[model samples]
Target: MAVVGPTGSGKSDLAVALALQLDGEVVNADAMQFYRGMDIGTAKITPAERRGVPHHLLDTLDVTEEASVSDFQREARAAIADIHGRGKRAILVGGSGLYVRAALDVLEFPGTDPDIRRRLEAQLADAGLAPLRTRLEAADPVSAARLGDARRVVRALEVFELTGRPFSSFMPAREYFQPAVQIGLEVDRQLLKDRLARRVHGMVANGLQDEVQRLDAAGLREGKTAARALGYSQFLKVLDGEWDADQATEDTIVATRKFARRQLTWFRADPRITWLDWQDPDLVAKSVGLCR
Candidate 1:
């Protein structure tokens, strides 16, 4: 089953608990959580928090390595099959909407063409997102309608340019997984914003800046996707002297809020999802009922 929520929605905590109770294994869907040495900033589940339950697809890659949504889908699907083979449920979790949808929809990405990649990279560098959105709109207005995300739009355009087909066309046009419940954690907007601010502040207190320093010292650059992770990138500005510490923190909070909104939009589109308010006292029971 799938679990999705905003950054500070305690997805990891709920996932761990559900896995333990259901005799299941957790699969990581959050993009940043896949990278090793990104523990604190990614808010990765600690060994203790895992409560001896198995979790897959987290910390299995180096920070410098690229993790495409396609790669995640393959790995997550394999994990789920293995869990089913072992007679245990696979608790798919985290807030990366694309990864979650990929696994749940059993998506098949088109093969990449190097020539297309080069051209798309050039377009990204020169004309920027506006032209990419225009291109996606022209190729597949349906897919464009489904995505307001600039990043997804660009990626779709890249796929189209390479294959002469809409990226959405690559998705399996029929059901894959037969039946699995989807649960989404939710919070009031003001409450979630407050929680996100506090989480950002906590990350700063927990050496998020020092983590950025370590990553930078280890040769991660602005162009790399890992370096572009929310708090990490903003802290890079602080290190570069482009922003003061306070400004850096403020920027992270604002960006996080925006990211959380996007996550909400993505999760809300799935009719299978059962929303659980964070404040619900019966959350465990409700979540368990979903699984049953």
Candidate 2:
């Protein structure tokens, strides 16, 4: 089973509760939560909050390491297999849409070569996205039309160089890798916005600024993915004296609300997910009912 929802939704707690009843362990699918010191900002589950249920893939990467969906796919599946081998259920949880799809769907990831990627990145840095976008449009118009940033454009080009195939050729066809249940928590828009605002403020109160400071000294800025994390990125400006703590908090709140909407849009598009109201009194019971 997989429990997915927006940032402020109670996916983690529900997953833990489901694990208690379903004899399951959680495999985290949140990309940011993979980092070692990204606890408060990512709202990572603490040891006590997990209620003794084992969680895999959380804190598996240093702040300097980039997260790869392909790598995560292999790790998540392996963890699920191991859990099943132990006669236990696996509750995959998180709001990272691509990571979740990579783990659960029939996705094919072309291999990447550091040399090719480095060369492409260097070209991007030197010439900017215009030249790269033009080149990509000529080779892979589909990807070029949709890829929003230089990083994705470079990735598409890198895939082409490495595999002699367009990056779009590998998009999964929504075929499930295994039989499973996916539960999505639905939140009221205004209520969720307020919740996210409060959550970001709570994160700040809980030392998000200090966490960002510690990770910055630990090479967080060099991390391709970790550096760009929601609250982490915004708070780094605070450390640089570019923004005050209050400004950082407000920015994070806005960014988090936007991210939550994106998450809702992504998960809602999947017809397989059974949606449950976040505030339901019997959310767990209803979720377990759906699983059974």
Candidate 3:
């Protein structure tokens, strides 16, 4: 089983409830939650919040390491196997759409060539997103249409160069890698926006800036993936005097709302996910029924 939804939609809590009821353990699919010492900002559930339900894959990386979806696929599958070995259901949970799919779907990532990747990276750095965007548009318009960020654009280009195949061809079908159930939490857009704003403010009040400060000391800026995480990236600006705490907090809220929208878009495309209201009174029961 998998619990997926936008950030701030209470997927973590729901996952915990379902786990306790279903005699299950959780295998995390959230990428950022993989890091140690990133607890509060990632909205990572504490050991107390887990309520003694065994959780796997949390805090498995340092702030300095870049997370890879391929690596996560191997590790998460291993965790699931271990949970099944213990005679417990494995509940995969998180808002990261790609990582969730990577763990539960038959997705294959192409190998990278250092020379090709380095050349692409250099091109992106020297010229900008426009040229890369043009190349990707001509080569793999499907991927180009979906990928807007430079990082992903460069990756698409890299894959095409390496495999001589359009990047979109690698996308997984609706089939699951293993037999499983997926529960999606749905929220009203306006309510979700308000919730994200409040959540960002709460994170700040709960010492998000101080958390960034501590992670910064531990070299968060050197991390490619970790440095760009939503709240951490904004708070890094606060620490650098680029933005005041208020500005950073507001920026984080805006970014989070946007991210939530993207998450909804991604999950909505999958027909396998059974959607449930975030506020459903019988959410756990409904989710468990879907598993049956």
What lDDT tens digits, residue by residue, belong to model 1 across residues 133-245? Answer: 77778898888888886667767877787788887788664354557788999789999999889988898999988988888887657335688788888898999999987
Candidates sorted by lDDT, best first: 2, 3, 1
lDDT of each: 0.83, 0.93, 0.92
Most accurate candidate by lDDT: 2
Candidate 3: where are CA atoms >4 Å away?
Answer: none
- Could you give candidate 2's per-residue lDDT for residues 1-292 as a string of tens digits? 8999998899999999999998999999999999999999999999999999999999999999999998999999999999999999999999999999998999999998899999998998898989999999998999998899888999999999989999989988878999988999989999999988998899999999999999999999999999999999999999899999999898999889999999999998899998999999999999989888
lDDT of 1 at 138: 88
lDDT of 3 at 114: 86
Q: Model 3, range 123-233, lDDT digits (tens) per residue?
A: 988998999999999999999899989888988999999999999999988788989889999898898899888888898999999999999999999999899999999
Taking every candidate in turn, the Cα RMSD to the unseen true structure, in Å, is 2.6, 1.0, 1.5
Off by over 4 Å in 1: 123-138, 141-158, 171-176
User: Which candidate comes out best when scored by TM-score?
Assistant: 2
